[model samples]
Target chain A: MKLKVFLAVFACKLTIKLLRLLGRGGTAIPGKIALRICPDLLFQLAKDVKCVVVTGTNGKTTSSRIIEEIYVKAEASYFANRSGANLINGITSIFIENSTLTGKPKKENAVIECDEAASKEVCRLINPAVVLVTNVFRDQLDRYGEVSGTLENILIGIKNSPRAVVCLNSDCSLTASIAEQIPNRVIFYGVDVPIYKNPVSEVSDAPHCIKCKHEYEYSYRTFGHLGGFCCPDCGYKRPEPQVSVTDILSTELSFTKVRVQVFGEDDVITINLPGGYNIYNAVGALAVSEAVGFRRMLAKDAIASFTCGFGRMEEFDLGGHSARIILVKNPAGANQVLNYLAGLSAETVFVCCLNDNSADGKDVSWVWDANFEKLADMSELIPEIYVSGIRSGDMAVRLKYAGIDEDKLRIFDDYDELIDAMKNQSLPVIIMPTYTAMMDLRAKMSTAFGGKEFWE
Target chain B: MKLSICHLYPDVLNLYGDTGNIICLKKRLEWRGIDTEVTLLPIGANADLSRFDLFFIGGGQDFEQEVLLTDLHGGKDKEILAAVEDEKVFLCICGGYQMMGQYYLTHTGQQCDYIGALKLHTVGSDVRMIGNYMFKCAEESSGSTIVGFENHSGRTYLGEGVSPLGTVLHGFGNNGEDHTEGARFKNVFGAYCHGPMLPKNPEFADLILQTALSRRYPGTVLPPLGDGLEINAHDHMADRMEKQ
Candidate 1:
């Protein structure tokens, strides 16, 4: 058994070295090969590590990054899947990479961002001390099948890791419901007050109650079905969260100040990122930190110091023009980006890069589920709209159907052409791209202007 | 003439941009100087179903489908079946299409009875058939080619009473084995293609509109609007599917 573990770790380390030499981002493949050699490679390497696995549809990366800052601020040695490889293979690789040849982990603490579908296998193997499920939404139907299926996957993971403290987003009925089925100690986090003044009516992934098929009536929805909700007939309601945002002091373009009650104590915290979703992430991270036994003040401060993850509200400068790329994978996430854009009073050029790649969810149909009508409403503020990526035409049509004028719509299939066009614009640009599209466009943007590789 | 379109169970059945189909129908009608009143009939919403000229039902998750079936038994199924028999235009996609069938035999051989509006039955599989597919409408219809995304595990086989919406040009259709894509009975249209089905395929959208409009205003023709963007988007997928 010891020889098998040693051989797997050695092979994985060698694979990473070869891939790095080939100028490739050695993320998930190496771990996959290691797992092939020894199926229990992660379980062996992660035996001694205290891992906080962040899983859900949205905010996994952002939530994990914030938790990483908390770990860093606590002055604890840790490692993470910083390359956005949240799957089983990628996670396995990260664990093996941070471990010695004998499968002993170098880092004592680990902040792992796990994919929703892969969370079941990941949690079972790693046996993490903390499992934080951010929220569940309809994402990548081609991969996860459906939203409930996504919830079920996370549930199975949590069920397997009974010893792990489960930190759930209480406001999300779909997420909060996980507490009902599991016997694990649960910590809930959510926003108590509505974040947005004018909330757009979008589709709720969990419109019906999980316990009973009754519709959920919300007392207040912060954004995208996250709020105080109660099912009338079933009596299943949003559980009282341990860490919650009580009031929003201010929300600027760069940062947001909110007063939150962390386990009965009121404290004001500043989330470095914008949008209501980040506020959820802030509370979620705080909850996970609490579950992991970190000091409350340290966790709060870490959230304030935390920077944006790759393509997750990550900003860039093109010549003199400013551009920010927000990675949008599904309708819920896209709507959050739209929510952020709604607050933009400044004149901005909105660019949407839609791709049908496997990572991007081959069905580009979810674009229709998003409220692009909000964009049409703010047509004056957004003078020009650029559609790029492989499915740029589909995006253009979606925007067109959303009532954005045909004259304002510009389709650019080439990244070079799109980036070149951005150079001439004096106005600030907000580029929203799918997962794979962001990689392609960001690589081009980084080369054209100045930035570092995401993995670096 | 004004057309009243009912969006059925939009809250539950709206999985993949299903509202886009509604938006497409409303916008296409408005473009031709035709008035449209869209009524959203979610679960437990009470209204006379016969009042609406056309109905649009989208796909949903397995859990949602189960929830919708409960609502259907609460009298929505009868209205849906009556509408189909009356030849009132209906556009049902994926789960919605499966609901119109006799029963969905689960992978474990568990039979879930659906509203038997169309003479068809579906068998659920563990593997989901999902991708962009192209198909040509059956000769009885416009015979125009349509392109859209199909994501479903249920392999639907049409009974003798119903005709197919189209012949599978590329990609898997009703079942991977059968080249048939969707089932069509009278003015009822059911398919797995839901790139929200209509926004990209303007011709198909117009076909549905013409059928519904002709019911009230006999010989009513829809004036064509510019569909350059729609055609370009449709052809992009169609061309890719053909190459494959």
Candidate 2:
């Protein structure tokens, strides 16, 4: 019976691979079968190899890629869902890509980036050896309901899985609270990065302490409550991280650089990503790799060479100017992009695109909260800012208030107009787009410019 | 010299990036040599509200409003009531406006008692309100057309004599009625438009800070904001929202 089932699955995968080779969207075919039958095979397959899974509301995509890159540098074959397709189909698709025709995976380790709700189901199937959660924020509230609910899903996966969890000690109050739930070794990663240049603190979502019901006080905030924090009443402070990222230099004139003071030695890693959150993302990766038996030096070297893990921080030379393509799906991600753009030296133009798709909360109010004003405060350097998307008018209004000059502001709710506005513009454009917006931006880039060859 | 600003429950009622509103106000005020002290008073933050010059509240989910209502209801100091009575500047937007009124009707029809500042009532239902919005600020409202996004699941009704912040541009406008987009009692101003409110709208921040300045320094002449102020071309959005 098992032999027949294996044969059918193997044949299905073979056919899909053929279809993919022949130019089709056959990537989802493996998941189409695995999510239904032989789901048990996933856990069995992962037992022999080291599997590190990172899932949370934010920072998981970048962190997962960083971890995978570290493993890749160590010469260990790794596979991760780099496309931010963090669901059942996405996980299965990643596993299938790493698998051979005989149902055995080619890689020794898999870094699966699971979605918030889907993480539990995928972990139950994959039984990963390590899990790293970056931070939790009030993202897609219409979809995820609340921050507590998102944390509950992460806790569900962490509680059941016997694998060690590399948790972010600074993810507000709830993420650290989950440290008590999991029996596995919890490796916590955090940063002591300074927010000096940024005089005022930007307000972020999801701040109530789960225990005392009082707002958690921040000694200092890197982003959201993902820094030193403590509750006033219950004394539930942010856990003392086992692995801390200190001496973090976010004042990078180029290449979102930071020196992570890990294990009594400063491991300086210059990442091709942007924002202080990326520092946390790297800390999440460095913490996980170090916990999973990779030497500290080897892990640092891996992240050092790692440039642009997929579209997380992909730089594109469009005709003449360089465009850093970073995905801004939610407020935290969007705010980080603003932070990066604020520190950038290039003659900058911000092409902020908004979409009401499932990834970008149908609630565009999240934008009103992002620190566009801070981006606006640094406006002397900024010549023009392009606000484009289905919600271009919204972004245009946002930049306008950011004290961005109307002439400097152009609203292109239409992609064609956005690309037309972007094509060979004199200033170095920072293509800060949401999820599917990137697809549209990439497609336009492919046709207008050369192709996805910029990624090469 | 310490001017206390009430960043009221920023972590909780902060639906939009209202924290940016406070950040913009603080930085701008500080730029003008005001010794600005921002006290983030969460749901149960330890701080004296009586010393507060500016009281600020952002938007949030209906559940968050419900959760915070009891705490906010209890913590309503006489100083806050006096501030409202005196028409001192308190910046409230969207859900904050809804919750600051007499009552907020939840989706289940339960009446949640508001702080009774605005003469209005907001009722929530199943259908959520989320989209980019614009508003034509009143003539006295010396600022650009208020442009931002409104994401809420509530409908607010302004009673007689109440004026909205401006005519709604896009988004759901103002709840179900053609009511005022925001509420004002002297220095206290409320609106639904948020793009983290102030970051994108320095003019509005200046207006709020001017209210603070008038209250604090009396007849002190304030210099106008320096150069780099640009006229944002979002009139198209206002035009589009008006047609809708």
Candidate 3:
């Protein structure tokens, strides 16, 4: 290795240690500083490791965790980016931390979760053995522009890694379209049956066909635009998935039992997480593991026992009352959360925290697209709705327009007061927070209550 | 009183929660005991545009805008022009606002034909002027400060025939080169604001409703509903923008 490479690695290592000592969890700065010294540090560090990169709008972190669980089950030596640091700089920091000062990778295997916008460069540098795209949705309009723009970014990333086997969600028309253009070996995973019992009328991010502008007709829809989509005019349709959820045997708040078909073989799997999106994540994880040449039974076992980390339906106890924090960034994801909320039979306290910070997309207008009006139908079950965060006023007005009674809406600008207000509530509480608000509130919740810090 | 709203290209030009403007308009009207009907006019939908009291068109992606341009050129452009001439209240936002002009010159120098309902034109740029923006309405006696989020690359310029909707108070509006934010030709209102441009600004929503109502029932006065929550929300956003 050159003197600059050695010095970059040493500096990155020292910065990580210093940050840990200071109780500050930041991977981007160290990786940035190291890259400033040596521009190709990540390429040098990640070149030797066999990586499986996960990139999509939603379920990236959760899918990465599930994939990591499979690696653990197989007893493979691997390191994954666990704390939501999926950007280029943060991902570079992970590679540096998992490698030696001589620029040799310490781990033989790596599972990387990459941001959609940064995936093109990351994939080109990492050159992963397998790339899993969970699904695509309208996410962070201010940051990513449009859903098609986001899809284009991911497509560019996949194009860079022609050798990598691409695992895609067939249900997502945007994701499935990648298979048609790329020469890479593609495997698809999706729910074969409709997840919802009732008909849904939510907005579709990909309403029109990707190939043509013709409207898509769905045989059955799982959620927002993810379904058995086919264009009448262009003849473009959903591809048959190799790994598919053939049937949802049972679904509960805690877990879901599904019959999954893996490469012509059928197996009844229990996804430890709830919701239909998690099932998609589970299937995508299995497809990626299978693409990476891992055993099907190991992937199934890992998914069956895996528990998700911070803010992806993370449960917490708020002074005797149970609260669940679900991080919502976009309309599609927020709609799914609202759909989950609409299914509850018991009365609950619903809290919506919206922030316009850089990480949270800066535009609070997406709250309107999220069909919060569905909550108005279940007004009896959801007694009170609390709007918090920096843009709580905007959220409060949004909920009011959604037919939520003005009497039911309360604004909590202060986090301490918001936490205190929910502490003594007897009913189950569901807290939906955007990215930045979730980070800040999760820290406060961890500090007040007993929970693991994000970096820990 | 009844107001018929034609939501143009709801399937294509519905970005950044632009449907929220329609929702706000509908709810605010319903609250005041006014009956309203909203019809979605997607591409290829042939509707008598002059029959509707109000016409609403929201923003869309660049690709979707291109799709909309084809349909507008097909025949809807003439109908929309007729509606504008008939004094039907029209609120077009962002891409929809851009389409109201004669043409849009894209960043790649490609010229896309538009509806030509207003005397305005746009030139697309590589850099998008995005953020929370505030502007004071320029119309006489309507000094209300409008607050909304603008995310657009198309810098629009008003011609001699049309007047600007508002003067920029805080953020970049319209071309970023001028203080003008949006264009106005009679009752037709076009702007880049899409918080969907009305939910936070109740006065603007009511103004659209009142304008539509007056067109049908001349000398009609709209009764004021409780606007405490709406005003609070509007003030909060305006204050945040002013502080920045």
> When superposed on Cα atoms, how far off is each prediction in RMSD?
1.4, 6.3, 1.2
lDDT of 1 by residue, A1-456 (tens): 999998888998999999889988868889888889899888888889998999999999999899999988999999999989989899989998899888888989899999998999999998889999999988988888877889989999998787899999999998998997989999998888999988677888888888887888999888888888999997999999888899999999999999999889999999999988999898999999899999998999999999879899988988677999999999999999999999988999999999999999988999998999999899999999999999988999999989999999999978899998888879999999999999999988888887888777
Ranking by TM-score: 3, 1, 2
Isolated chain B TM-score per model: 0.97, 0.87, 0.97
Q: DockQ for each of the predicted structures, in order? A: 0.83, 0.25, 0.79
Candidate 2 per-residue lDDT over residues B1-244, each given as its tens digit: 4356888877677765666676667667666777888888766566656677888887775445545866766766444666777656788887777766788777787877777767788887778666667776776665457766676667888766566766665556667466347765556678877666665566776878877777876875556764242223245445555787
Pick by DockQ: 2 or 3, better one: 3
CAPRI-style docking class of model 3 based on DockQ: medium
lDDT of 1 by residue, B156-217 (tens): 99998899999998889999997998989989899998888889988888989999999978
lDDT for each residue of candidate 3 in B77-129, tens digit (9 for 90 to 100): 89888889888899999988998999999888899888888989999899989
> Against the unseen true structure, what C-alpha lDDT does each candidate score?
0.90, 0.69, 0.89
For candidate 1, what is the TM-score? 0.98
Q: Indicate the TM-score of model 3.
A: 0.98
Candidate 2, residue A423: how far the Cα is off, in Å:
4.1
Q: Compared with the real two-chain complex, what DockQ does model 3 have?
A: 0.79
The DockQ-based CAPRI class assigned to model 1 is high
